[model samples]
Target: MHPTTTLLPLPAEAPPSLTQILDEVTTVLCHILPSSLSVKSFSTRWQVLRSKLATLKSSISEVSDSLHWSESPLLQTLLPNILSTLHRVQTLCDQCSDPTFNPGKLLMQSDLDMATGWLSNQIHDLDLLLRSGVLRQTNAIVLSQPVPGSGKEDLGFFIKDLFTRLQIGGIEFKKKAMESLLQLLSDDEKSANLVAKEGNVGYLVQLLDLNSHPSLREQAVSAVSILASASDQSRKFVFEEGGLGPLLRTIESGSTGLKEKAAMAVEAITTDPDNAWAISAYGGVPILIELCRSGSTTAQSRAVGAITNVSKVEDIRTALVEEGAIPVLVQLLNSGTASTQEKAANCISILASSGEFFRALITQQDKGLQRLLQLLHESSSSDTLEHVLRAIYSLSASESISRVLSSSTTFIIRISEIIKQGSIISQHISASLLSNLSISDGNKRAVSGCMGSLVKLMESAKPDGIQEVAANALVSMLAVRSSRKELVRDEKSVMRLIQMLDPKNELVSKKFPVAVVSAVMAGGSQGCRKRLVAAGAYGVLQRLTEMEVAGAKKALQRLSGNRLKSILSRTWRA
Candidate 1:
């Protein structure tokens, strides 16, 4: 029925032997040995080769213990050579990736030919070793004892070995040990905690010193980054153990890779509020600012992160601004990658929080406002949107910035939309910006067009700060004749303002609504006055006139003129 119902057996598919995998990896590596290539193309090829080699290394490590090396003396003899070849390949990869090295000029055609010949010989040796029944070996010599389980004792012993190696091993051995420990700490939080508790931060700090090998120092910084990232205790240990000096030095002068790792570690340490001051004290702020300007993209990003964390403290923020970080940060905002832009924006937001002086400097010197507005229009990231909005809000406190922002129709409309649709933080910041911008007559007129949105914000069940700011914005809008009529004509807005005059409300809440009512009444618009009286404004004003609150007397006077003051005087006389 089915062509004699005979199912021919499928060809037996053989799994790749270890030698085959090694040969495949070596072939990939050999492809990168071509000279006379474009720098960009060479970089691409090099990255591919590096990835393949890393995969091969990981594969070997995963199976090394199970390999029966003694069963085939030939394979056993070649094992160390194979590992040495792999390490040399990795070293070459590292050299290529080094930021300082110009790969295009470093390797001539003759040099590449030599490298190719050497790699060919290594590949042939590996083939010979594999053919001598290397993959068939089963009897293994247990040269190293295995730690049976991942118990506390096992972890302790493992950490002790790492510490011993870090303390006394030669440069290469120290680098490997540190890299292994860093990987272990990153992979296992328990190990990081144990390392931190055991006071190993001092050794890590020592490895970062200037006298150490650059590669070893880089590994030490990475280890510190992992440890600091794991927990607050580790962060404190790193900070207290005098790690900041070496870390900052590395950021200032180490290789590009080292700078990135050191910046990251600094960021981790600065997350604790207490250590932030220490960084500033160590002259780290200016160095971080410099990195943001000249370091690689990754280092710039990490530097921005560290600056953001450190800028959380008021004193440090002032110090950062004085170090001319504002303009540099603005530059990064305009040209850096998306992550860098967000971090720079966030750092500027914190710096802007320090005072109006920094705000003016940021908005005036660097075209910061223009850049922020552009990012706001282009970015879909909520974090970027939030930070940029906050920075704008703070910078708008400057009178000049307020006028400038109000002059831009697109800026004003976008702010209105953000208030309507953004996250809670964004909405609040937008409302505050509106309030700040509305201080100028031009801003008052511009913001007045969005009266309905501001009215809705004032009517919302938001926090006291947001509602207060929204009310203040409406007050500014009502002070403008064109916006006054629209606000008065909106019966819902009139009712919301009347509701805010409650005596039981917080003093801050009552202030803005009273001022808004007073502005509308003082405008002498018959329609607005009618609406206010119709919305039970007289009773609210009458009650406020009885309280000893600030602005109550002025509000009553504006609402009812001299009659309210006379009535109040009569009530006191009674």
Candidate 2:
């Protein structure tokens, strides 16, 4: 970008005179360059060679411009040699831009990286020969590093002047100049950011907006993304350069690939609250949501993440959800690629979890249950299934959910496996869903065999694990008409269920009580209540009458609400 950004110094002494160095540069350009190399190839290698050509051009221009040839024998001889050298360098940059030659494979040459290093050393030797105070031609190669200044100046200060100097030279060298910057962007974010610190970010920003080469534009955007990720300091450095406006604009205008990178850029930019708030200030949500609606899978997924980041504020989150992101996300569950689905799923879950705000979708008011259920069945990955289930649970209201599960008694099998095998997060999902997971009439038939397993489990395990699971499975089993007799007749089965109701014993040991209470409150129409109450779960509820916990509170309310309602109804029947 600008040469003023770096503090690179001039070498006071080194081997090789100016002309000797020019001769070596000439040999490398004319002889070392591949016969098939194009101007673009040579141009991309501009960083390693531009300084020498700039110096040679400067010396020749001086001899022709003002230095009386008679004034210095060096200028007279230097003029002709410089002429030939500049001609070769020009021809090399031209060849690089040609299609007849390959730029890609050529840069990948076996010795090129080493050649670049060697070329750098020769240019260094030439810099040492030029006098510091003499106004040399603007012909020296631009070094993107800090070095000793011409007069102990800050390298960072000279950068803007260097860029302004290039501006005067016109963009004739733009093809090569931009290539150098792109390389700089990828090479080290710190160096790229330094160029930005000197205000070179404006150059990249301006370039992204121009109707330019697709690949080149992408490179420009990618460079900005790199700088933003470099350091916390650089992140703001880019933002202040007026970058987000153009970037968000580009996300709306570019192809899927462009949108993808732009979304990724948004991700890096939104890594913190202030940055995210900046994006929101820049109209981040609408752009991201539009991208989600129109872009490819990767684009949409990343856009979802970007939207989520910016939505960390409640207003922003509500804005997105109100803007109809919920339905769009539900559609995305089946859209895009696998990675896209995973991301969209997560984004939707985050929004669903923020508040009881998504009651419409969760309660089946928006008819989300069936759609979510299908995803849970169709998804192959354990995580994807977990997100779908949680989102469904988060979005739905409980009683409406009950109607949906009424037909699927066996629904808990898939979920039980999730607890046993999935991530800790998903295992928690299993715990959360266990209370609402209903036993289908078919699952009722299956609980008989597992009943024996459940009893054996309690006898040998940790108190919390055994009781929690026993409570959950007991609640589930009590729902089965097919498994009810054996379960109740194990006569001692009633006592085991009763014994688990100890409030003091339940907390450290059990997480399954919600289902246990739900089962007891609902499982017995006649004999079941006495069976469960005989088991002492009713007394346990009595003990918790004065307790508090979000879950325990809900459990107590449900336990009380259903028992009183059941007693009133039964009294009328009598």
lDDT of 1 by residue, 1-574 (tens): 5466778999999965656544654554454334213234355444454454444444444334436533433343344455456555545655554668655654633344444454455445444333333333342221122243477755655565556445534455566667667667766776777787753679789978889776777678888877777788887888889988889998988888888888888988888888888887798999999999899999999899999998888777778878888889899887998999999999888888678777778877757788989999988788999999988877877777777886777787787778767777787788777666645566566556567666667655666577777777667667778788878888877777787787765533566677777877777666776678788888887788787666878777676664556688999999
What C-alpha lDDT values do all the predictions have?
Answer: 0.71, 0.57
Per-residue lDDT over 1-574 for candidate 2, one digit per residue giving the tens place of the 0 to 100 score:
8577777898778655555554554454454344324334534456555554454445433433432223332333333444345455555455555668555764444334544454444334223223321123242334344332232134343444344322322243444445555565565445645666664676667767858656657777877777766777777776777777778988988776777777777776787777777766777777888888988777777787777677566667777776777777767777666666666676666767777656554343354565567667677777777677667657544555656564554456655555455555555555455545554656556435545445434443443344455456556665765465566556665565445446655433333553544554553444555555566656666665555432545555554565788789999999
Worst 10 residues of 2 by lDDT: 125-134
Q: lDDT value for candidate 2?
A: 0.57
Task: Give the TM-score of each candidate.
Answer: 0.60, 0.52
